[model samples]
Target: MNFKDYIRVIPDFPKPGIRFKDITTLLKNGPAYQAAIEAMKQQVAELEIDVIAGPEARGFVIGAPLALALGVGFVPIRKSGKLPGETVEADYDLEYGKDKLAVHKDAIAPGQKVLIADDLLATGGTIETTVKLIQKLGGEVVGAAFLIELSYLQGRSKLGSVPVRSLVTF
Candidate 1:
């Protein structure tokens, strides 16, 4: 399937001089949704992940189903104060401001392999910070996955040596 066609291109979304690839169009189409998960699943087939951790919002949309497809648990790395009970948090700098993410104290057991998933990988700061939180909780980050990756931004460099997989790039 040409997943690219399912993604709508919106000019200057959330800002000027930026083209946002909107996934909502794909989400509304069942075939595109399944194709995306299958493609991502194939990319991470060799990772041997024990759990899939996705950031809040868009992450939940993709991560949950991917986790289910992979037959693994899904852990949510949410915005600060979103998770209940004891949580570990990491602060990261965005292009315009700083933001924090938190995960449950027991999101991952020590040594358990985790794959971080998100809708897009731009600067990689958000996902890298997610890995930090996973590490803080003693989880081994085996890899990271994404639906779309903006290659021009060089986000993969921020991810260090961990394996990073993506279904499509723009």
Candidate 2:
């Protein structure tokens, strides 16, 4: 299935001159949602991921299901103070300002392989920080996956050598 066909392109969303690829439409469609998950699963099946780490909000939507499909634990990388107990944080730059992302201190065991998941890959700021948080807790990032990628933003550049997999591009 061409999942991208289900995505809605909204012009000037949250800002001017930005064409936002909204996934809400796709999420509401049963077949499209399944196709997306299946596509992502195929990409990471060979990675041997020990856990799936998803960024705040949207990432949780896709990442949780992906983790379940892979039979792995799901770790959430969220904004500061969102998680219980001890946590580690990584600060990063955004197009507008700066922000920090944190993960449970013991969420990822040392030397375990982690696969980062998100709904979209924009500028890679959040993903980069998430990767840093995982490494800080001693988890190796096996691969980073996204449901959609805005290729023009060049988000992958910030990710360096980490393997990146996206189901759809625009």
Candidate 3:
């Protein structure tokens, strides 16, 4: 399927000179949403994924369903203090400053294989920080998946050896 057809692109969104790719259009369409997740599932079908991890908000939308499709558990990587109990945190540089993400200290077991999923891969800061949190807990990152990727941002470069798959790119 032509996934881009289901996405809405708004120019100068959130800032001037920026075009935001919105997946809410596709997400609202049952067929398109299912197809997108199925397509992403196929992309990582060969990976040894014990669990799927995604950042808060949009990432949860993609990752949870993907995990269900793959028959694996889903873990949420949230902003600091969003999670209860003990947690592991990683700080990453934002465009203007630094922000932190945390996962419950016991969310990922040592040596478990994990696949990171999100709605987009832009500058890679979130995913990079997610990788750190997983590694800090001794979880092996097997691959990363996305619904859309801003290739010009070169976010994948920051992931090092972790493989990546995206259903759509802009």
Comparing 2 and 3 on lDDT, the stronger one: 3
Return the TM-score for candidate 1, rounded to 2 decimals.
Answer: 0.97
Clashing pairs in 3: none
TM-score of predicted model 2?
0.97
For model 2, the stretches where C-alpha displacement exceeds 4 angstroms are none
Model 3, 55-128: lDDT tens per residue?
98899999999999999999999999999889989898988998899999999999999999999999998999
Error of 3 at 102 (Å): 0.3
lDDT string, candidate 1, 41-145, tens digits: 999998889999999889999999999999999999999988778998999997779999999998899999999998999988889899899999999999989
The lDDT per prediction is 0.92, 0.92, 0.96
lDDT of 2 by residue, 1-170 (tens): 88878999999987998888999999999888987898899999889899999998999999999999889999988898888879898898877788888988889999999999999999888998898899998899999999999999899998999999999998
**For each candidate, what TM-score against the reference?**
0.97, 0.97, 0.98
Which model scores highest in TM-score? 3
Candidate 3 residue spans exceeding 4 A from truth: none
Candidate 3 Cα lDDT to native: 0.96
